[model samples]
Target: MASLTCRADCTHPANHRHLRFVWLYFTTVNLSALDLNLLLVFHTVLEEKTVAKAAAKLHVTPPAISNSLSRLRAVIGDPLLVRRGRGLVPTPRAQELAPRVATALRELERAVGDDRTFDPATTRRRFVLACSDNDQIASVPHLAATLASEMPLAQLHIVSIDQLKASDGLAAGIVDAAVVPTAASHADVHAEPLYVDHGVLVLRKGHPIRAPRLSRAQFNSLRYVDTWIVLGRAGVGTKMMDAFLHRHGLVRNVAVIVPGFAAAAMIVATTDLAVGMPMRVAVQLAKHLPLRVAKIPAPAMPIEMQLVWHARTHEDPGAKLFRALVADAFRDKPRR
Candidate 1:
């Protein structure tokens, strides 16, 4: 084979195109002969900046990591990493290749590692979920119990994240999935309707509000407790209720604002303040507290809770299993 080379000043379009082809061909040839696992070692060593640290991370011996580094250097024809006083530093070429190699390794792992059959009873995978306070109240208990019984070894971490940042967190791999009222519009985020719940009025068990319903006048006159979190500005229920009330020329007296739905529920259960929240959430809270659930006087606002995840993990077995578990746990059932 003739040696392929490109001049610095190859101004001709055809020459530029040929140069690109040659570069791609050489890259493919280089990668075809390289061991994919070596890339993992290379990335670890670059990240850790020492063979000993990389060995510890990969659960291998330092000599093995050094040998792998030698092989990588020979194959790539570059001193990928160089030793300084006590640490190693990546060369210019290694620095340039680091991100691409890391990305490729992550993608490869996601493609192969997660495609295996999921065995919930045996696997020790951990799944992180981003949920609101309401989701924590309504869904977490059931989910925790179900997972504890069905997947004893698996772990679950529920985190409170801003709803608006849910998509960003999923995309960035901060959380595996998010339980939100509305789906995000990001192209890389995937959303599924988990369940549809409606807003209801919550008050103390023997408060003034009666069963079945409360008149619009009574509803407007009662003091209200609002749950205001950092992301409360984008609350779907609040926005919808405001719009509905605006249309009817009515507004509830928001006498108090609490940090979360749990707190609001607690306040409403013992005081004259009443809260409007999802029926499922209110019902769950009422089970533990002296609270009563009643129909919202205004037109009903259906809160469609959704499960959102990144497209990158769409096919990941663990992610898929967790998504299925959440959907099954929260799936709406007919009233008996």
Candidate 2:
């Protein structure tokens, strides 16, 4: 039993010619009579345009190069290269094959030749991340700043979690990473804790339900703002806020339904609507608005926000750095 592998210095001038030849040879589907030697001979003939030159490069006599070309010419059913006054000119078929070969050779060179350590500061690689609306508010700005300072040449793309359900961007390589709840975690993904947060109810400062503690009945009597998207309604924190309501067979009287925390906060600030949101973001919103915080009537709901990457990219160097930056971004905010 033998194993085959491709490990080559594709940039080495001598090897490049052979790779170019291999690429050219592949275009003709019939390889039943393939011989490695003839492929090299044909490419060398087209490349050097003279047997004497190719032979000189290969450290072989012109007769040997000529014999190898004769075999290739029989299999290809073309003259391949014909003698001019003092050199050779490729036949039309051979000339047509050159461009295709060059394209594949370029791809090959990129894959094997450019194998080196990923340097974040120098790479112009594009990285994609997916997050729901609130998670974006939580991590995007700080991550953007980190990118601007350390990974200046790298590009960042932030997409919504909705795109992931339509197509698995992470496993498919369209998305590099995501900031999501641990419920999305699976065997094929790597999850790293970004932050631990809990939900708090935000309302206008002069609202009627300003009691030191809110009873379930009082909590239900008020109008509420709900977020119905991935992280808004279906998220762990939201479910925790509603847990008490579920247990007591009572639900919040829905007044306004929005897709995100910011929207919920805005609805809560001006109107009688009260929204349950992460305390970290709610605190920030409260600072600039006429908003007041209230403990959620529900028991402790610790939202575990995590950074997730497909196992495919879990060990990628650039991805590792990206993950570190994401972790650093959340680490800056106060934990409730």
Per-residue lDDT tens digits for candidate 1, residues 136-173, read 88878888887787789999988886743633456435
Candidate 1 overall Cα lDDT vs. reference? 0.74
**Residue-level lDDT tens digits of model 2 in 193-236:** 77787767788999978875577787878888888765333555
Off by over 4 Å in 2: 1-114, 231-244, 248-250, 332-336
The reply for model 1, stretches above 4 Å from the true place, is 1-115, 163-167, 229-239, 334-336
User: How many clashing residue pairs, candidate 1?
Assistant: 0
- Say which candidate scores most in lDDT: 1
Q: Please provide TM-scores, in order, for all candidate models, with all chains considered together.
A: 0.65, 0.64
* Candidates' C-alpha lDDT: 0.74, 0.71
Residue pairs with clashing backbones, model 2 = none
